[model samples]
Structure formats: structure tokens, C-alpha cells
Target: MSESLKNKTVRGVGWSFVDNIASSGVTFLVGLVLARLLTPAEYGIMAMIAIFIAVSNSIVDSGFSNALIRKVRVERVDYNTVFYFNLAVSVLLYVLLFLASPSISVFFKEPELVKVTRVIGSVLVINALAIIPRTVFVRDVNFKTQTKVSLISSVSSGAVGIVMALSGMGVWSLVGQQLSRQSLNSLFLWVYCKWKPSLEFSIESFRELFGFGSKLLLSGLLSTVYQNVYYIIIGRFYSSSLLGQYTRAEQFNMIFSSNLTSVVQRVSYPVLSSIQEDPKRLREAYRKVIKTTMLITFACMLGLAAVAKPLIVILIGEKWLPSVYFLQIICFSGMLYPLHAINLNILQVKGRSDLFLKLEVIKRIIAIAPILIGVFYGIEYMLWGSVFTAFISYFLNSHYSARLIDYPTMDQMKDILPTFFISSIVAFFMWCVSLFDISAYILLPMQLSLGILLAFIIYEKLRLPEYLEVRQLVCSLLHRKNKLDNKQIWTKN
Candidate 1:
């Protein structure tokens, strides 16, 4: 990789991590407050309609953002075309969802979902307005600006949600949070990104981008639906309170799996795409990414699983204790997610959206039996089923990456195995620590500190290159910042 691209990737990853930390921290704290103030049934109500909103959001972009990012040189008309197309689709989708709200309520046997669905569905339209600018930022790898946008939006909206929840807004507090965040995020993106849409709408541009984007659209739609299938099944078959517990478990698990993986996936895609022509460099970069991602995420998920009970009780209180085992079971599956994401990102970087769609279909098909079987048995069965399916999906996601770049599943597994082993050892030690006679308030921080210290010691002793790379990058960033501060002070003097 070129030095400029490498530098950009490093900077992008740093800013993305900062963005994830800020946004997720705010969301986590706010969720803790809301969980105490509101009942599980209230959370379950929002979970019931979450699929509709997610599917609508997918339809709005339809993978055009990926298409734009993949293009060698994006034209003004391309942006204008996608902007208008997304806006039109989002509006039509909102209208359709608005009309279908009653049917949704009837299916879930919850009449309150009708209004909640309509209100939250509006986020699709609001989010569509910012697609072009967000795409531009991603393509340019300008995550510093993206960080500011996310932090402001999350903090402001989280505060609003907290206030409303405390004031007894109940389920509407969650709705208010969603709407406010999307609205403010869009507003801020428009303000920070000077890109504006023109009156130019080219059918040719739309068709050209759509050719590549359509496969991604289908793939994304399938993936979104499948991911939300659990919520659908749980809410429909079981009590809303049960669904709420499951949602809470997933939420806590995602704080590690999704947020951190997003940082790697976002930065790596554009950076890898820039080096797509060189298979050797691409493979090397891909290997480094997967290794580093697994090193961190594996350790996190395992450690979280070990401390799940104490963490939940301390953070969200004993009311959410029922989610403890669910969270622990789900973390086992969550550990594989970063692997799945990085492997799939290779397909997009190689402009192989067709394979992306194919893999999605096959994986979902393979996943269905386990999902159905788990649902039939119970929620615990379903959670264990997910753990089984996650490993299978990782293998499936790795197939195309092997063909395209010669980085086979076994080879990838071999790369991550050492880190996985170390993480397991550390998690075992932490679990032993939890068995001690101690209060959760003291145990939680003690477990965290021990995990971090053990992870660093093992990585250092093992001479893990990814750990050293991350350490060096962080030191370099801090060094550069200190130099700049000194330069500014000298200039003032």
C-alpha cells in the first residue's frame, strides 16, 4: 500500500474508533437510565417495529453508497442522481409503511406499534437526505468530520431521551430518541459537508450505478431481514417482556461486536479498494486487518461473557439480570462477527457484489434450520443455535475471499487462532475471579483491569504484530498532536 493510503487508513481507524466510543458510550449510558425508568414491555414494543424501520432504511440507500465509493471517479451528476432516487424511494417507502402500520400492529398483537412504526419510519426519509454527503465522506475517508457529526447527534439525542424517560414518556422516549438523532445527524451532516444536490437527474447515471449497487441492495435487504428475524419471532410467539430481555442482551453484545467491527470494516474497505489491483498487497492488508480485528474483538467478547452477570447488575441494575445468560451465550456468536464482516468487505473491495449476494443467500438458507429449530424449542435454544450458525456463516463468508484473494478460511482461522486461544485463557481466569466472594461494584472494575493487563502481557510475550502496530499507531498520533500543539504555542510566542 502507498504511504498516503496507509496514513489515511491509520487516521481513519483512529477517528472511527473515537466516533464509535463517543456514540456508543452515550447510547449505553442512556440505555442504562432508560432501562431503569421504563419496563421491559415498553422496550419490547419498540423492538417489535424495529424490523420495518430497518428494512425501510435499507431500501432508501439500496447500496448506492457502496456503488459511489467503488467508482474510480465520482461525478457530480452521479451524486445528484442517487440523492433524488434515494429521496423519492424513502418517501414512497414511508407512505407504504404508514399504510401498513395497522397490519404490523395486528401481526404483533400490539396496537401501540401502529403510531410508533409511523413515527420511527420517518427516520428513513430523514436519513435519505444525508446519504450523498455521508457517501462522500466515506469515499474520502474523512471520518474526523464524521466523528463530530456522530458525537453531537448521539449526545444531544441521548439527553433528550433521558429527559423524556425520566418524565414518564415511556415508549415514546425511545421514539423521540430515534427521531431526534436522525434529524440532528442529517442536519449536522448537511452543515459540515458542503455538497449540495443540483437539478440534474440522469437516468444513465442511475442505471450505471444501479448495475453494481442492485446486488448489494438485495444482499443488504436479505441480511437485514434475517438479522431482525429473531425479534419478529420472539415478539410474535413470546411475551413482550421476553423480547425486551433478548433485545437488551443483543444490545449489550453489540456494544463490543458491532461497534468495533464497524471501525475496521469502514476504514479497511476504502483503503483495500485503493490497492485492489495488487493481489499480494491486498491479501497482506486483508490478513493484517482480520488478525488485528480478531485480536481485539475476541478478547472483548470473551471477557464480556465472563463478566456478564456482574456487569449487567451493576450497570443496568438487577431488573435486567434475566438477560445475563442470554448476553453470555450471544457473546460467543458475537466473537465471530468481526471475522464475517472483514471477509465480506473483501468482496465489496474487489467489486464482486454478485458473490456478496450469493453468499448472503446461501448463509441465510443454511441459517434458517438452526433459527427455526431454536425458535421451536425456546429462546435459549435459539441463542445457542445462533452460536452454531455464526461459525458456519464465517466459513461461508470466507469462501469468496479465498477465491478472489487466495486467503482461505483455514488460513484466516490459523491467523486468528493464537489470539483466540489467549483470549479464552484470559476469560477462564476472569471467570474464576468472578467466583470470588466480592461485591459486583468492586468485581466489575477488577475484572476489566485484569483482562486488559493480561491481554497486553500475553500479546507482548507472544510478539503479536497487530498489538505492536496498534500501539505504534496510537503513539504516533499522540506524538503528532503534541508537535502541532508546540508549533502553535511557538507561533503565538
Candidate 2:
């Protein structure tokens, strides 16, 4: 890859940091408001609707975004073809979702889900429309426009949701917010980009894109099925309250996990696609990406688990105390989420979609059946099943990463072992601190401060390249300010 490409990737990631903060802030406010406005049953129904929407979303775009970005020579005709194709599939998906609404409601024994499913089903189509235009923004590395698009969408949705919540619209508020965001954002994206599609279809171009799309489609399908199966199983077997509890916990876990992955994956995939021919540089880039992703993901997840009670108590309410355990388990399950995105991108860039799809399919087959069986025994067993699935899935994900780098599975583990080990040891000590006869207010902050201090100290002691980079950044800013002042003084003289 050219140095300019690397610089562009760096700039993209830097700009995306602002997008992340905007998204995080809006989501936090909306989640807090909605959690109070809606009940567990409401969220449970929304979760089922969310599952359908999410799974459908993964399939709707035909992975055209990735396919377009990966290929060296993209055409207006091809882009238009993908756009029209995705629009067609998205319409079909909406119809299918609407048709499935009654059955889905019956499947869960929640008749009210019919309306909810149909309402959120519209978003599938809206999101599909957004894909081509949104990808256009990212293709040329114009994250500034992308950031504005995202911020406007998020803030507007949050405003609409708050109003709906006040008017007793409940779940519809969230549904409307999502649909509005997609609709408005797609409109904006179309206006921002110069590219517009013609009503043209090419069989050859379709095959080229679909060949990649099929693998991503399958991988996405399995991953989606694997994820929703958890909620489906829980909802089918347990009460709405329990399912809602799991859903809330999972939602919060994903808010962090998805945001982390999105921030990095958005930058990583395009960059990887550009660097597809060079293995060594790609591997090095992959390593740094994984390192930083793990450092952040592991810390966020474990830290949340460590302070689960306080967070839930402060954020939700006392009624959600049962969810604390589920939240903790989901946190651990999500620990590998952010870092694994790079591996997925590597597979996408290498055009190994078939292998990627097969890997996840095999994983779900091997992983899900046992969990399904375990749940039949009891809820406690089900919880254990979740914990078991997470560890095994992490290993499976790493298997793909290992194949890419010609590194051993354990060596892959070795890459993240330091953070894992340090986080575990620190969490254990903090747990010890929690055992003391003091209020959580005291112990929580104490452990939070001390544990962070210890982690930073250990990280500093290791003196990773990132540590030196940070130090240099601070020094450079100070030196630049001095230079500016000196230049001004010299001009005055």
C-alpha cells in the first residue's frame, strides 16, 4: 500500500473517534430514557423485533459494500447494479418480514409482536438504501461527511425518541427513531455523494459481486442466527422478564462491543482491501489493530463486570438486579468482539468468503446444539452454556486469525495474554476489595481507581510503542506551542 493510503486510514480512524463519541453519547441518553419509559415485557417484544431486524439487515445489502470496497476497479454501472439489487432484496425482505410477523408473534406467544415486527421491518429497507450511498462516503475516505451524517442521524433520532417516550408511545419510540434515522441519513448521503445509480443490471458484474456477497451473506447469516438463537431460546423457554433481562444486558454489551468494532472495522476493511496484495505489512497492521482492540474491549467488558451492580443499579433500577449475572456473563462473551473484527476484515480482503462462511457455520453447528441441550436441563445450566460458548467461540475465531498469519492458535492467544492476565489479576484483587465491609460507593471507586492505576503502570512498565507514541504526542504539542509563541515574539521585535 502507498504511504498515502496508510495516512488516509489513520486520518479516517482519527475522525471516526469523534463519530464514536457522538454515537456513544446519544445512545447512552436514549437507552437511559427508554429503559425508564418501557417495561421488561416491552423490551422483550422489542428484542424479538430487534433480532428479526438485525438478522435481516445483515442479509439485505448482499455485502455489496465490502465487495465494492475490496475490488480494485469499481464502476458506476456496477455500483448502480448493486444498489438496485440491494433495493430489490430489501423490499423483498420487508415483505417477508411482514409475512412472518404473525407466525413470529405466535412462535413467541406474544401476539403484540405483529405490529412491532412490521414497524421495525421497514428499517431493513431503509438501511439497505443507505448502504451504497454510505459506502460511497467511506470509499474516498471522506469521514468528515460520514461523521456529520451519523451525528445528525443519532441526535435527530434521540430527539424523536424522547418525544415519543413522553407521549406514551413506548416501544414505538425506539422503532420510529431507528426508521427515522435510516430514512433521514440515506437522504443526506444521497445528496452528499455525486454518484447516482441507473436502472441497469449486468449479469457478469452481479456474479462478481455476488460471489463475494454469497460468502459474506452466509457468514452473516450464520453469525446472525447464532446471535438471535440465544434470545430465541431464552424467550421460548423462559419468561418475557428473563428474556428482557438478557436482552437488556446483551444490548448494553453490544453498544460497547459494536461501537468498538465499528470504529475500527470501518477503517480496517477499506485499508485492508487497499493493501490486499501485501502480506507482511497487512500482518503488521493486523497485529497493532488487534492489540489496541483487545486492550480497550477487555478493559471495558471486565470493568463493567467488576462494577455490574453499581452500573445496573444506577442506570436501570433495582428491579433489574437479576440481570446482573447475565450482564456479567455477556461481558465476558463480548471480550473478543472488537479484536475479531480485524480477522473478519482480513478474510474479506483476501476474498476468502467461502472459508469465512464455512468457519462460522461449522462453529455454530458445533457450538449451538450443546447450548440448546444444556438449556433444557435448567436456567442455571443455560447461563453456564453461555459462558461455555464464549470461550469456545473465542478459540474458533482465533483459528481463522491464526491461519491468516501462519501463527499458532496459542501464539494468537499469546498476543492478548498480557492484557487478559493483567485484567484478570486486577479484577480478582478488586473482588477481594469488594469483600470488605464497606459500601459499594467506597469500594467501587477505590477499586476502579486502583485497578486502572495498576493497569497503566504495568502498561507503562512494558513500554509498548503506543506508550512512546503518547509521550511523544504530549512533548510535540508543548514544543509546537513554544515555537508559535517564539515566532510571534520575533515578529514583534
Candidate 3:
């Protein structure tokens, strides 16, 4: 990689890391308070409407934001076209969802979801408005602005959610949180991003983008639907309270998996895309990203799994104990999510949305049987099925990456397996520690510290390239910070 691109990638990762930590931390805290305040049934109501909001947002985006990012030369017409298209789709989808909310409520046997769905679905419109501007930031590798936007949105929205929960708003508090975040995110993006759409909308530009993006649109819609299918099944077949427990468990898992994966994938895609034409460099860069992502995310997921019990009991109380096992099981699946994401990103980087869609179809097909079988058995069965699917999905996601740049599934696995094995061993040790009859407050911290310390010690002893690279990256960042501080002091003097 060029030094400029390398530096951009590092800076992008830095901002993304800070953004995710701050945003996820605030959301995690707010969720803890809300879990204490609201019942599982209330959270289940929010979970019930989650699919509608997710699917609507996906349709509104229609993969155009990615198309914009992937395009080497973006025209003003492309921006205007995507902007208008997203706006129209968002409005139409929201209206459709509004009208269909009653049917959804009926399907889930939850009468309260009718209004909740409509209120939360409004976020699609707010989200749609910000797509163009956000795409600009991402395409430019300008994550600093994105970080500020996320921090502001997360903090403000979390505060609103907490206040509303305290004021007895129940599920509406969750809805308010969603709305506030999206509204603020859009508002901030507009204020920060100077780009604006003109009255012009070009059919040619639309077709150009759509030609590449339509497959992604289908793939995204399918992926979104598949991801949320469990919620639908649980909500429909089981009790709302049960679904709420599952949702809470998934949320805890996601606080680590999703945020960390977002940080790596967001930085990896644009940086990798910048070097797509050079197979040698692309392969090398891709491997490094995979190793680094695996190292960090593996440790996180496994460590969180080991500490799930004590952490859940201490943070959210005993009422959420049922979610502990669920969280643990899901974290196993979450460990490979960054791998899945970054592999898929390689396809996008190589402009193979067709292969991307094809892979999605195949994986989703493979996923269906496991999910169906699990549903017949039980929730735990379904979760174990998810673990099965996650492993399978990794190979499927990496198949094209191998063919494209010779970074095959087995090669990628070999690169990541050491980190995975070491982390797993450390996590098991942590779990053993947790078995002691100690206070959850004490046990949680102990497990975290020991797991982290052991993982670091093992990595250092192994002299793993990825671990050393990460250490160097941190040291370089600190060095640069000190130099900048010294220069600022001199200037002030």
C-alpha cells in the first residue's frame, strides 16, 4: 500500500475505533438502564418492529451509497440521482410500512406494535436524507466527521431514551431513541458535509449506479430479512417476553461484534478498493486486515462470552440471567462476523456485486435449513444453528476473495486460526475462573482482566505479526500526537 493510503487507513481505523467505543459504550449503558426500567415484553415490542425498520432502510438505500463509494469518478448527477431516489424510496417504503403495521401487529399477536412500528419506521426517512452526505464522507475516507456525527447522535439519543424511559414512556422510549439518533445524525451530516443535491436527476446516472447496485439491493434486502428472521419467528411462535430476552442477549453480543466489525470493515473497504487493480498488493493488504480483525474481534467475542454470566447479572441484574447463555452462544457466532464482513467487502472492492449476490443467495439457502430445524427444536438449538451457519458463511464469503486475488478460504483460515485458538483457550480459562463462588461484581472484572492479560501474553510469546503490527500502530499514533502537541505549544509561545 502507498504510504498515503496506509496513513489514511490507520487514521480511518483510529476514528472508527473511537467512534464505535464511544457510541457502543453509551448505547450499552443506556440499554442497561432501560433493561432495568422496562420489562421484556416492552423490549419485545421494539424487537417486533425492528425488521420493518431495517428492511425499509435497506430498500431506501438500495445499495446506492455503496455504488457511490465504489465508483471511481462520481458526478454531481450521481449524487443528485441517488439523493432523489433514496428520498422517494424512503417515503414510499415508510408509507407502505405505516399501512402494513396493523398486519405486522396481528401477525405477531402484539396489538401495541401497530403504532410503535409507524413511529420507528419514520427513521427510514431521516436516514435516507443523510445517505448522500454520509457516502461522501465514507468515499473520501473522512471518518473524523463521521465519528463526530456518531458521537453526537448516540449521546443525544441515549439521553432521550433514558429520560423517556424514566418518564414511563415504555416502548416509545426506544422509538424516540431511534428517531432522535437518525434525526441528529442527518442534521449533523448536513451541517458538516458541504455537498448538496441540485434539482437535476439523471436517468443515465441512475441506471449506471443501479446496474451495479441492483444486485446488491437484492442481496442486502435478503441479508436484512434473513438476519431478522429469527426475531420474527421468536416473536410469532414464542412469548413476547421470551423474544425480549433473546433480543437483549443479541444486543449484548452486538455491542462488541457489530461495533468492532463496523470499525474494521468501514476502514478496510475504501482502503482496499483504492488498490483493487494491483492483485499482489491487494492480497497482502487483505491478509493483514483479516489477521488484524481476527485478532481483535476474536479476543473480544471470546472474552465477552467467558464473562457473559457475571457481566449480565452485575450490569442488568438477575432478571436478565436467562440471556447469559444466549449471549455466550451468540458470541461464538459473533467471533467470525468481522471475517464474514471483510471477505464480502473484498468482493465489493473488486466490483463483483454479482458474485456478492450469488454468495448471499447460496449462504442464505444453506442458512434456511439450519434455522428451520432449530426452530422446530428450540431457541438454543436455533442459536447453535447460527453458530453452524457462521462457520459455513465464512468459507462462502471468502470463496470469491480467493478466486479474485488468490486469498482463498483455507489461506485466510490459516492466517486467523492462531489468534482464534489462543483466544479460545484464554476464554476457557476465564470461564473456569468465573466458576468460583465469588461476587459477580468482582468476578466480572477478574475475568476481563485475566482474559485480556493472557491473550496479550500468549500473543507476545507467539510473536504474532498482527499483534506486533497493532502495537506499532498504537505507538506511532501516540508519537504523532506528542509531536503535534509540541508543535502547538511552540506555536502558542
Best by lDDT: 1
Cα lDDT over the full model 2:
0.77
Report the C-alpha lDDT of model 3 over 142-234, residue by residue, as the tens digit: 988888988999899999999999999988898888789889989999999999879999999999999889999999988999889889889
Worst 10 residues of 3 by lDDT: 369-378
Off by over 4 Å in 2: 1-3, 436-444, 466-493
lDDT at position 416, candidate 2? 76
| Clash tally for model 3 | 0
Off by over 4 Å in 3: 483-493
The count of residue-pair clashes in candidate 1 stands at 0
How do all models score by TM-score? Answer: 0.97, 0.90, 0.97
Error of 2 at 371 (Å): 3.4
Please identify model 1 stretches exceeding 4 Å from their true place. Answer: 484-493
lDDT of 2 at 206: 92
Structural RMSD, model 3? 1.4
lDDT tens digits, residue span 90-130, model 1: 99999999999999999999989998998899899999999
**What is the TM-score of candidate 2?**
0.90
